[model samples]
Target: MAATTIRTGSGPLTPALAQQIAGDTSHIVGFNILITDAHGTVIGSGDTSRVGSFHEASLEVIRTRLSATHSAAQARALEGVKPGVTLPILLNGQAVGTVGITGSPAQVTRFGLMVERQTEILLHQASLLRSTLQRERELEDLVRSILAFDPLVTGHSTLLDQANDQGVDLTASRVAVVVHTPGRTPVPSTTSEWLPRALVLLRESFQHRQTIAVSISANRYVVFAHPTPDGMDGILSQARHCVEQFRTHLGSDVEIGIGTEGAGPTQMRTAYEDAADALHLGRRITRRSVTTIDEVRMEQLLSGIGLRARQRYTAAVAEPLMAAGDWNTVRSTVIAWCESGFSLVGAARRLHIHRNTLIHRLERIEHLQGWTTRTAVAYLALYLACKTNEFDAAEPSDS
Candidate 1:
């Protein structure tokens, strides 16, 4: 049966929910149920055929905010209704809809009241869910605006007003952290479905602190956290804990990048970019799940050079290696060596090769390319080229 529907000037009750109430309540109570909006029209009913009928008893209940019942004999007098009990569905003490059961008044009155209470609870829960979603949307919009804000623009005052209304203090010092799931599978991909799950998982981690978290886009979540009084060291420590919290719930696939701390809009925006860059570098180069801007500053600086120029530099520095298809290995070797502090033993261990093999490879590079990592200039250039290639490959192709 169809449940009661809300039409123009009907009620906040939607036809879909009314039908759900009618179908579910009837199944549970083993009786036919009819749901009516404020206008007394059945939008949903356990008996699908009765939908769109008017129940005069329901109209009276809506008007009086009370329950009405009828004996089997009295049921004949009411239009579009049988001998039953109808109770107003109250939300905040106002009737929004009615739930009616079809049976003798004495037999159905208790079940009618039970259905009424159930419908009211459902309506209230729906209202709360709507409110929470709306607030989340508003908060996301606020974060988007703040991230896009430019001090030279005229909208700063308006943005400040909005932030003030939301009880967000823009002047407070905050460090931006960007969390992303690069290739999420076996999990929801839809932003609306995915965001809440992640947020709920991280809610406990954020409960003690002031954090403004939002999903800026698909798979990209940002959290502007208030830095603790202990400064950079303390903030990073907190960020590590936060990363562990995320990974514990979300799994090892999650990656997080942390930014520097500062107050106001411009710095906050910069911090967001910093965190994003850190995440990019961490994911592409180190394959690390948690990365801080401070840890990747050199790579970040190297990334500032245009991809084309960096490509040219890499080509120029290792021209012979490129021609012989040895640059890829050299690049890997250089990055690993540099990262291992140019220690032959550590570099060999990192590459899972013997020291003699490493020495022979270096000898082959010098003999064929005449490029040795013996001097500071040569080592630095080679190191930068390797780093540049990592970032360059990560960059999206302009063509």
Candidate 2:
């Protein structure tokens, strides 16, 4: 007769199927199904009343990591209960319990062999699915960590705010602080021990859970910290302290910039930008020190110049004038003009120079450089050139 396919029954070994399989064998096919907990406590079984039954053989299956086998004789008194192949039932990739068949060696072995073969296929498929699920979870965790960053830092606030707002339910009461590691050497290529150590210091000092989403670039690491009700000052102070503690390892002077505190998940990017702006200022102005975006009041004045333009302006004007020795005076003059709305009168008054003296200097500048300060455009260009020249003067020759 065709073998009965009891794929689904009262779970593996019901009395009916067991009797059928037992009857098919020439010898007695004695068997018992066992169940156990994570700690080897038998909780239940296919047998009706085995609810609290405990079996040493069941424990052996877990401890020894071996497949089940049938035999005419039991192994030993202390070997738990020995029987045919013991089929382990697993949940969550852990063996929670097992099923076993016992009887005459030949018939029991045949039955066990059949059951073990089919069970192996099922278990292998299950194992592959479990592994795939686990990998998916790990990938999700990494993505979540990256998305948690406030994207407003890179000059795309409106778009980032909308996208993140639609995608995630972000906490509204948190703030972001940007810690900038200057130069190429101080920062490592990846987020390894040395980099993570700096992060640890920041988290500890601020008393917040710190998460490194990912590296923004080779030289920039974005740190997200929840804002405390104590205020931005406390947050900034902690950042300052953290930087100071790890100053030596950081290579370049460590400058921490904090963004403005605000509400909504969309606000993170804005906050990040604020902090980054603070860091940028800190690096350029406060060399070997810390600076905050709040302290950089001329963002409005410097708004029109992009990074590349600013660099070129600095190299062209500031570098040369600085090299020529009157950089300090030129800087004072340009700053006065920028601060005074580019009015020659206001600039002169601020510098305590006579209008005629200012006029004469202007004339001399035009004559010496073949450039005129007659129009607003010319004045603006001169102003930018002068500022660049000033910065170049301050920089070392190698820089």
Instruction: Supply the global lDDT for candidate 1.
Output: 0.78
- Candidate 2 Cα lDDT to native: 0.54
lDDT of 1 by residue, 48-96 (tens): 8888888878888898998888887777787887988989988888888
The 10-residue segment of model 2 with minimum total lDDT is 1-10
Off by over 4 Å in 1: 1-5, 8-12, 72-74, 151-154, 185-195, 250-252, 311-399
What TM-score should be assigned to candidate 1?
0.75
TM-score of each: 0.75, 0.43
What TM-score does prediction 2 earn? 0.43
Q: Which stretches of candidate 2 lie over 4 Å from their true place?
A: 1-169, 181-195, 209-220, 247-253, 297-327, 333-399
Encode model 2's per-residue lDDT on 68-158: one tens digit a residue.
6645365455243454456565545556445555545455656665554443444455456556445434433433443455455533454
